[model samples]
Each structure stands twice: as C-alpha cells, then as structure tokens.
Target chain A: MSVTLINLFAVPNGKEDEFVKLWEAIKVDITKQPGFISGKFHKSLKPDSRFNFINVAVWENEEIYWKAFEKSAAPMKEKLHQMGVEMTPALFNVLFEY
Target chain B: MSVTLINLFAVPNGKEDEFVKLWEAIKVDITKQPGFISGKFHKSLKPDSRFNFINVAVWENEEIYWKAFEKSAAPMKEKLHQMGVEMTPALFNVLFEY
Candidate 1:
C-alpha cells in the first residue's frame, strides 16, 4: 500500500527565505525519485510557531520512500541539518478518502 | 490565501475500526461545508505507535475552516472526544509545489 509521509520542520528564526531556497533545490531532486507520487511544502499560518514548516508526500510504500530519501535526498538532508533545520518524519497508510 | 490543516489524532488500541467509522461521518459532513477544500484520513503504518491517525485537509483560510468545523463538525468532534480520541491541529499556508 502507498504511504503518506508528514515531515515536521523547525527552522531558525528569520531564516525562512534561506530555508525555502534550500528546500526548493531538495524538492526538485526528491520528486524525481521512483515511487514519489505527489508532495507539497507548507509554512505555518502562525508565524511565531516553533514547528513552522511541514512536508507532505505520498509514496508507493515505505521502502521506496526511504530508498529515494537515502539515494537522492541525503545530501540535501545533510545540508538542511547543517543549516540547523530540525526534522521529524512520520509515515502513515491512507485509511479513507472522499 | 488557502490554508492546509493537519490534525494529528491518537486513537486507543484496537479501536481503529470504530475510529474510522466516526471519521467517515465527520468527513462527509465537513466536506459539504463552505470553504472545505479537500481532505484525507490516514492510519499509521505501525499499529503499535502512540499516534496512529492523521487528518490532512485544505481550506480557503483559517476563518472559513473554523466556521465550517463549528457549523457542521462540532457534534462529531464531541463524539470523538467522548470516545477518547485526542486531536491536535496545526494550520499552514502552501509554500511551494513540485
């Protein structure tokens, strides 16, 4: 079954623009990987919130999602880490839709 | 501007089926309300995890989303509360797509 990935991100204050630039590059590379269905990046409506960014994506399954992340997105992920962006990812199976 | 809403849910053990049923009713009513863009219910891949469900949705904005939820989904929300489902919601604006 396909899995949904929700990644929560915390970026340093006043670094939104820089973070978005890095994410643009990472998003381009990651979406090209096998089993990547669709995805989007979101910024919190509440500007002062600590966890201010979220990345939502759908992949064919958990394995392919991780494979793509490790193979194509690891460097960018590292770049994000170096920039002090904290990320927490959770995966789920879609139960229902309408 | 459009807003994305991610509602994290923690359902008790072995109550997946019951939770899904309540969510089905909720999804139906909520989607019919004005400003309700779209949504999906997701169940965690790991059954043993503490947080086992998530509701991802898009709305026209924060105001309309709350209006819709209050007008149409409050009762169901209460039912979920009575069933011991814990919910945490975060709102966001779409930052980018690829």
Candidate 2:
C-alpha cells in the first residue's frame, strides 16, 4: 500500500527562510527517487504554532519511503541539527477520506 | 486563499477504535458546513509514533475554518477530553508543492 510521510518540523522563529531553503534543496533530490509520488510543504498561518512547517509526501510504500529518506535526508541531519529544527516524521495510511 | 487544517492527535494506545468512532461522528457534521472542501484521516503505520492519528482538512480560508470548528467541534471538547485524546491543530498555507 502507498504510504504518506507526514513530517512536522519545529523550526526556530528566525530560521524559517533557512529551513525552507534546505527543504527545497532536499525536495529536489527526494522527488526524483524511485517511489516518490507527490508532496506538499506547508507553512503555518499562525506564527505561534508549535510545529511551523509540515511536509506531507506520498511514496509507493514503507520500504521505498525509508530508502528515499536515507538517500535524500539522512545526510542532511547535521545541517538540520545546526538550524535547531526538530522533526517528527512517521508513515501513515489513509484511514478515511472525503 | 484555501487553508489546510492539520490536526495531530495523540491518542491512547488501546482507544484507537473509540477515537476513530468519535472522529467519524464529528466528520458527519463538519463535512456539511460551508467552505468545507476536503478531509483525510490518517493513522500512523507505526504504533509508537508520537502522534498516532492526524486529520488533514481543507477549507475555503481561516475564517471559515474557525467558524466551522466552533460549530462542529467545540461541543465535543468534553468527550475528547474524556477519551484522553490530545490535539494540536493549526491552519497552514501551501508553501510549495511537487
């Protein structure tokens, strides 16, 4: 089954632009990976939201999703850490929709 | 502009079914409200995920979203509290897509 990777990022207040730039750079590579289907990066309208940025991406399945992540995102761990960006990522199945 | 309402839910381990039932019940009313565009309820494939369930919904705009929430969800606050479901909701704009 296709899996949705929902990653919520707690980006520091002043590092929004930096975070986006890094995300865009990562996206360029990740989207070309084997199972990538689609993705959307969202910025919270409310500045005070605990998680200011969220990335929702669809991959063919769990294995492909992890493979893509390891290739595209794992290397950038240090950079993200330096920016003080905390990420909460997980694979989800669409339980219901409308 | 259309706004995405992404609400992450930290539901107790064994109460997953009960939580879904309540969410479905809320969906029945919320979907009929003006400006309601689309919605998806996602259940994490990993049971250990910090947020086990997420509700991603789109509305015409922030104003309409808050109004709909007040009308459809505010009343169920007590029930959700009893279920020990914690929610983190925020309205977001599409920053980029692919």
Candidate 3:
C-alpha cells in the first residue's frame, strides 16, 4: 500500500536557505532508499511564519519508510541543529483514499 | 500520474474545531469525485500560530483534481469565509516521484 508521511517542523526562519542546502545534500542518499517513492517540501508562505515546513513523503510501505528515515534523518538533523532549528519533527499518517 | 496538492491557508485561530466540522461535512462529496486518492490535514503543534493549516490532498491527475476542487471547495469556502478566514488558498504542485 502507498502511504504518505507528513513531517512537520520548524527550522530557524533566517536559516531557510541554509536548511535547503543541507536537505539537497542528502537527496542522493534519500533517493537511493528502497521505498522512496516521492517527496515534496512546502514552506509556510507570507504572513504566516509560525510553522516552518510541511514535508510530505510518500513511501511504498511503513517498514521501508522507517529504514530510510533511520539512515537519512539523523545526519541531516545534526546539520539542521547547527543551522539553528528549534523543534523536533511532528509526524502524521495519511488516511484518505477514494 | 499521482499528484499531491498542498493547500495552505489561514483560518481564525480559535475556530479550528469549526473548520473541521465544515471540512467533514463536505468530505462526502469530496470522496465521490474521480481521481481522488488521498488527503491529510496538519496543524502547528505549539508555540507556532501564524499558519493555520497545511493540507495535503493527492489526486490521480490534475484534471480530476481541479474539477473536484471546483465542485466541492466553493461552498466549504463560503462557510470558512463566514468564520473569518482571512487568506486565499495557497496552492503547491507536487513534483516528487521516484
């Protein structure tokens, strides 16, 4: 089954550009994952700066998704911290199918 | 092709519950549309209140997706307007697929 993972979190507002640079660096590894079907990153646009980014990644299955997250997120996380992100990720499962 | 639609907008802060009620009411019509695949809504957890919602809705194609939006979004939009939402919907096209 296809599953969507909504990863919500904040990176320091001023470091948005730097955060993308770090994220792009991990693309090579992230793409090589077994279940990495797709992903898209969205920033809270103008007049709204509370939440930083809502990243939705679609995967083949939960098992494969976790493997990718375990390997890829930690290092990128370290870099995000160095860039001054202030919060942990908030996770949500996708549940709409018609 | 599967496309994820990221709908971002602001709704009055204290009326989150009312928003859900309006959303759920139209979900029935929403589910009956062709190409409707999935949808998920997320909110800022804490210490962040600028952006109201990050809603991710997936579709089989752009055609069906737009039609569904036209048929279903208008009325729910009005209810939302009556509730004091002060922004236009910000649309993002999904560009990730492996």
Candidate 4:
C-alpha cells in the first residue's frame, strides 16, 4: 500500500518566495531517494490561515516512507526550522480512490 | 490551474467503517459533478492522531471547486455532521509538482 506524507508549514509574511526556493531545493534533492513516487506543493487560498503551505508526497509504503523521512525529511526539516518555518507532519495509508 | 480540497475528519473510534461507507456514497455521487477530477481517501497510519481520515480531491480550479463544493460538499458535510464526524477543510493552489 502506498503511503502519503503531508507536511504543513507556516511561512512568515514576506518570506513566501524564499521559503519556496528552499522547498524547491529540498524537493529536487529528495527525488533522488528511494520510494519517492510523486510530490506536489500547495499554497493556501485563504489568506488568514497561519499554516498555509502544504507538501503532499506519496511513497511506496510505510517502511520506505520512514527511510526517506529519516534521510531527506530530517535534514530538510532542520533547514526549514533554521529559516524560521514551523512544520507539522502526518503520515497516512491510502484506503480508497475514485 | 488545478486546485486541491482536503477534508480532514475525526471519527469516533468504532465508527470508521460507517464513516467510510457514508464517504463512499458521497464520493460516488460527487464524481458526477462538473470539475471533479479525482478523489482519494486515506486513514492515518499513526494510531494517536485526533483527525485520522482525509479526503483529497483535485478540481479544475477555484471557481469550479466552489461549484462542486456547494453542490456536493455542503450536503455531504451536513450528513457527516449528523453522523457525528467533525471535519476541517482547506483549499490550496498548486505551486510546484515533482
């Protein structure tokens, strides 16, 4: 079963461009890791939400997700934190699709 | 430009199956609407998360998303509420994909 990893972040005002550039680099680097299927980055349409950016990634399975997370996510998360972006991450098992 | 709608639900411990069934019906019904591209339902891999169920749908764009949401989502949300499922929804604009 493919698993999903959703990372939601809050970017400080006026730092959207810089944050996206950092994310772009992370995304490119992580694609080289095993089990990375696809990834999509999204920005909130609502202006008021504090945590407005979301990165949705699909992996081969739970184990693979953890492997990639440890190798790629750990460092990327640290970098984001250093840049002052806070992230909330959650993992999921896809049940049904239509 | 495609838009994504993510609905995160918190279902009572024993009602996951019932919630999925209701979601199945809603999914089938909503696919008949315009601008409904695709939908995926997922369950939390982490056992302790409060909001475990997620429905992710891709739409043509913001306007079309609103149209489908008003037609399908409004009623389905009401039904889910009646069934005691609490949902949090967010809309997003695709920024980058890889």
Compare the candidates by lDDT and give the number of the best one: 2
Instruction: Give all candidates' CA lDDT scores.
Output: 0.83, 0.92, 0.64, 0.83
Instruction: Compute the lDDT for candidate 3.
Output: 0.64
Candidates, DockQ: 0.73, 0.92, 0.21, 0.84
lDDT of 3 by residue, B1-27 (tens): 565666555677678787766666667
Candidate 3 per-residue lDDT, tens place, A1-98, comes to: 66566555567657877766666666667788998887777655432545455567677876787888898888877877787775434333443333
Candidate number that wins on TM-score, 1 or 3: 1
Q: Local error of candidate 3 at A35, Å?
A: 1.1
TM-score of 3: 0.56
- The digit string of per-residue lDDT tens for model 2 on A40-61 reads 9999998889999999999999
Best by TM-score: 2
Full candidate order by lDDT, most accurate first:
2, 4, 1, 3
The Cα RMSD of model 1 versus the native structure comes to: 2.2
Model 2, stretches more than 4 Å misplaced? Answer: none
Give model 2's DockQ, 2 decimals: 0.92
List model 1 lDDT by residue over A1-98, tens digit each: 89888887889888888999988888878878999999889998886765789888989988999898788766777888888888867888887776
Candidates by DockQ, descending order: 2, 4, 1, 3
True contacts kept of 2: 0.96
lDDT measured at residue A14 in model 3 versus the true structure, 0 to 100: 71
Model 3: lDDT of residue B5: 63
- Could you tell me which 10 consecutive residues in candidate 1 chain A have the lowest summed lDDT? A69-78
